[model samples]
Target: MPTPSTPLGEFDLIGKYFTRPVQRVALGVGDDCALLQPAPGMQLAVSSDMLVEGRHFLSTVAPERLGHKALAVNLSDLAACGARPLAFTLALSMPRVDERFLEGFSRGLFALAEAHGCELAGGDTTQGPLNICITVFGEVPPGQALLRSGARAGDDVYVSGTVGDARLALEAFRGTVALAGDHFEQARVAMEQPQPRVALGLALRGIASSAIDVSDGLLGDLRHILQRSNVGATLEVDRLPRTAVLAAQPLALQRECTLAGGDDYELVFTAAPAQAEAVQAAARQAATPVTRIGRIEAGSVLVLVDAQGQTVADHFGSFDHFKS
Candidate 1:
């Protein structure tokens, strides 16, 4: 393998690291445009995400992990809609064509793609600041795809897996918090290599009334559902699930992280009160744990409450591209 200083041409770079035989797409790399064929009775779900250096990830992250995350974040979008993976196109910009970095990045990206049975289609590469943009394609049956606007007044709000760990990791990286070595590693993994709950999303089809992936934060992402569904919610702050590490933090910190910590790729969804049993069944079938956190209400404001049913003040703000 050549070093970072090696003069690798554009076509050579794509051919050597990004090219792969197509399995799901009608056409793949080496073409002007990739062709896709969605299955009958299904609607195509498309989403794209961009990650910039020093903004989306730290400068010290391993290339392989960065690669995995670049795709994982986009797949999280598809999971929110209960769509099955199909294919993706990668558009990358880098300061230079470093063979070592390309090797590790492609390895991480393709590994996750193969696990989801998603193939690489066609895309472009250019010389610039390090940036990764991926456009993913998925399919879901008509009328079965989950949306943010489906929650009702009586729907139960649930979140799959845990939240706040990624924010904790980010705090550690930023020197705002201190953590033991192993604890930092665990949280760091949660931040860098989030597992998209595709299986859980698939199982929740026809079960979840509304759905959104926890990319920005639980409270922030949940607001999208509330606004779109025209409903309010009373979240039991103490009931928000967390790992033991995060649980050991201060009460205020724990609430802030769980409520407003972004980068946790878990799913936050709503379902009917009558479908509680069905929701549990779906979780069991998907091998993911889900916890009921709150209930949707008639108003248009989100209220936070303690375990004792006291209304708590809302103060934390989630990640905003411009504000943060």
Candidate 2:
């Protein structure tokens, strides 16, 4: 537990670990709050997400990684909308705060914030069941934020990065697998550390007709864009990038994990068929692979079809927001 005079005093806590990096800014960390100066005509985008132990992550997971992922996932939302991360406010509530935990948490958080170009603004701190909520601010050109409703019939669907590693990692982390081996390492890292597709998301702004981050199952999350865009999708099973670690598993398990498992912060987007080359080039530049996973159709259902066009059942069904 932390006290006023504890080594983890909020002042030192903020200064030693949460320092903001230099970037395109109206202000840096330290003040009533961090201020921002958006370039002329750019609009502001704000988003937030909370991570709770034993819910969003395991209670035994390291605090530093939890801090990083909580922030990174929220930033992923901003990136999905083609926004440049500007600043963030963190709200931390823990049952009992330890100095080591605080220090490690802040260090992990700042490292990602620095890479993502977001400032650590002001927010409240308190005692609770260890929930980390991060609200991030971003900037995008006026009237140009990517919306989920922009997908059109005939647009090619795409996704950045592989799927399922995070979910596999979570299961392994919870001791579900004793034989996971190096596969466990891959999945654990994917789960504990999420790389928000900031650059790809930004580049896709004007190009992708619609986009979303796959925090939920890929099919479930893609349905959001398709539903909003008033179209259907035919997901191609062959194109999903399954890591070697993930592929070594049984086929059914692999498909189930990739389609329904959450926490892989990859971009699922739709673009004109003419833009496929550009999308491929941009992804190449970022050194991130983009796979052409499907095509938008005129119907309203998001369906999966094999190369032979046979329909597959919902692998794990849509991830439920609530259940007993």
Candidate 3:
């Protein structure tokens, strides 16, 4: 165990906190390279995400939640592709060793990893500004993995869970919006501990035509599918799913938070109208709620509509690393 009295070396810190017995990987920590064996007839799905202090998260966030969020974001990418979690590698950088921080972080990281059967492969730790990078690996059977380029005209657009609450929390943090104590805490949990819809992705394998995780906001992320599939969409802005707190906000604020509020980590997907029942069944099986918010169209233009079928202009762009 790490102690505050003695300076902890990198190898000692890793062994004390990050290293664990291998479950899914052939080789875990303490190796040149971790070995992963995919199931027969399965294709590997991989994704990497880096979180920086002040940019991705606030300085005051608990180390436990930070650890959970770090892994959850990468898992969201796998969920977008209808892939099953297998293993992951973590690269951590911090100014100095904090025993308490490492203990809480590893606890939170391993809890989520064990829940999804994802093993920690191997990684590096170094002294620097606080940053965390994780590369996750998953698997899907051939011809079964979903992609952003599979959407076609006439497909129904759907989103899992809710959106905008994370953005709502962010605005609260920035003092742009004032929320009630309970509401703020609810939104804070949404922001810091997003639930990745992995089971929903697995259930929608054959049912969804295309899918993308809502990390960079719904409209912005959905636009990727649109551009890749060479199609357009008519999104019913009023139909965007959100929590009660977001719903009670002003209409413009609600739209901004739900439409351009990044970090929701929900799955946005498309399917044919004929598969509506199947989509519902899949949602039920996964124990996740999904809302049909739009439909793909032939023209390469995204149109936003209100409840009364009136067209609304989209002014709320999504989060951009360079622009935001």
RMSD of each: 1.4, 2.5, 1.0
TM-scores for every candidate against the unseen true structure: 0.98, 0.92, 0.98
Q: Per-residue lDDT for 1-324 in model 3, tens only? A: 556688799999998899898886888899899998889889999999999998889987898999999999999999999999999999999999988899888988988898898999999999999999999999999999999999999999999999999999999999999999999999999999998899999999999999999999999999999999999999999999999999999999999999999999999999999999999999999999999999999989999999999999988787899998
Candidate 2 Cα outliers beyond 4 Å, as residue runs: 1-12, 19-33, 174-176
C-alpha lDDT of residue 158 in model 1: 98
Regions of model 3 farther than 4 Å from truth: 1-4
Q: Estimate, for each residue in 264-304, the C-alpha lDDT of model 1 and write its tens digit.
A: 99999999999999999999998999999999999999999
Residue-level lDDT of model 2, residues 172-229, one tens digit each, is 7667654456667778888888899999888886788999998987888999998899
Per-candidate clashes, comma-separated: 0, 0, 0
Models ranked on lDDT: 3, 1, 2
TM-score of 1: 0.98
Candidate 1 residue 283 C-alpha distance from true site, Å: 0.8
Question: Which candidate number maximizes lDDT?
Answer: 3
**Minimal lDDT window, size 10, model 3:** 1-10
Candidate 1 least-lDDT 10 residues: 1-10
RMSD from true fold, candidate 1 = 1.4
- Most accurate candidate by TM-score: 3
Candidate order, TM-score descending: 3, 1, 2
As for TM-score, the candidate ahead, 1 or 2, is 1
